[model samples]
Structure formats: structure tokens, C-alpha cells
Target: MSREKGKEFAEQDLTPMTGAATDVAPLGRQQKPAHELTADEDIDVADWDRVAAMAEFKQLVLAKRKFILPATIFFVVYYFALPALVGYAPGLMSKRVFGVVNVAYLFALSQFFMAWLIAALYVRAANRFDGMAQRIISKLKGGR
Candidate 1:
């Protein structure tokens, strides 16, 4: 509305416009103050560096690299190959597949399916990674 009305509304709003409301807890649950919450936690802030250096963490990194690197390489190659084929091997790519759909067009369309397939595969692999990460964190926390 008017600038004065806007200013009045802004003044009436109790919530801060920026940054998270640290005082509020979920579902109307009463939370301890920030300092108290940090003090009561079992994790030591100093040990975070040590946790990152742990063998379990290294294994997690290696596992992710193993899956992600190959998937990335594969997708990059497949995605580029379509255009490369169209440019370099135009005759081959121009060959009709269905009625008017050429090999190049089919290959380009298959990229969408390839992307979805890669995403699905990554999600499956990431679930395993999540389990590994949780185990590593649990070990670091001196739990199960």
C-alpha cells in the first residue's frame, strides 16, 4: 500500500526479516538457549578435524570418488558424442530411424533418458554413501 502503511506493517512484524530465528524450536517445543544447547551436546568442536582425518571418512571419500568420477566421465562423453557425431559423421547421423526422425535426433533424444538413468543410478549409490557416512559419524561420536 502506501509507504507509511508499509513502514507501520514492518514495525508491527516481530520476526526479523533476515537470518534464521535461533530462539524458535520446531512444533512449539521449548528449546534450551543457544549457549546451553551447545554446552550440552556430546560432540567436541575441536575433534571435527580429527573426525575428517579418520579412516572411515577416507573410505567414504574414496567410495564417492569411485562412483561419481566414472559417472561424470560417462555422462560427459555421452552428452558430447551426440553433437560430435552430428558434426563429424553427418551422413551416418542423417540416416532415417523411424519416419522423419534421424539417427542424430534419436541420439539427442536418448540423452534425456541417459541423464535420467544416470540420476537414478546416482541416487541409488548415494543411499549407500549415506549409510556409510552415518556409520562413520556414529563411530566418530563413540556410538554404535
Candidate 2:
């Protein structure tokens, strides 16, 4: 597009991100309920109690807990280990593996990669979760 068109395009409103806490909507954005913005497929009409009580739903929740609990614990431990080691084991953290770069720097940098890896893993796991959820929806819709 031309520069002026691009500028005009950039001036257009974007959707307000869901879950943001603010009295006023942010500039160039409008707040809309999720149900209004996306195809529902009657997702909002599912009976909460029945859905929660289903064996598949129970399994799905369990799967999430199993994966999430450990990942959270590991991430927390790994994340805080940096500061803990720096404070408690300064000598170890200070040991230089490469010239001018020490263990502390390397470990800190690894946090970025670690976060990305966890995100990638979660995406894979989320696909399975989505499939489980869809199956439960189908069963609820009498497609079983």
C-alpha cells in the first residue's frame, strides 16, 4: 500500500484485548464480548454441570493439571534458581565458560529459550486439549 494508505490503515481501530482491566477502552480499540466476535457453535449453551461431570471432561482436566502443575513448578524453580544461585552460590555463578561471559549471564539468557520451549510445548498440549474438548462437545450434542 501507499504510505498515506498505510498511515490510514494504521489509524483504524483494533479489537480491545480480552481480560484487560480498564474503565475506558484503550485508544483505537473497541471492547466487544467474545461471544459476539467469534462463531460460538453453541459453546456458550453447554450445560456446565454435565460438561464438568463427564468422564472425558474429567480426563481433560486431569491431563491439564498433570502437565501444568509440573511445568509450573519446574519453571518457577528454574526461574528463581538464577537469583538464588547468584546470591547463595556466587562463586559458581561467576565461573566463566566463555571469555567475558559467566554462568550467570548464560543461565539468564537460557530463560528466554526456556520460556519459548515451554510455550511451544503448551501449544502441542493445547491441541490435544482442544480435541478432548471437541469430543466432549460432540458427546453432549448427542453425537455419541
Give candidates' CA RMSD values in order: 15.1, 14.8
Displacement of residue 119 (Cα, Å) in model 2 is 0.7
Q: How many clashes in candidate 1?
A: 0
| Model 1 per-residue lDDT tens digits across residues 99-136 | 99899889999999999999999999999999998787
Please provide, for model 2 over 1-144, each residue's C-alpha lDDT reduced to its tens digit, 9 standing for 90 to 100: 122332333343322345646444345555344444456432333345555767999999999999899999999999999999999999999999999899999999999999999999999999999999888766655523
| lDDT to native, each model | 0.72, 0.74
Q: List the residue pairs that clash in candidate 2.
A: none
Clashing pairs in 1: none
Q: TM-score for each prediction?
A: 0.67, 0.67
**Residue runs of model 1 more than 4 Å from their true location after superposition:** 1-46
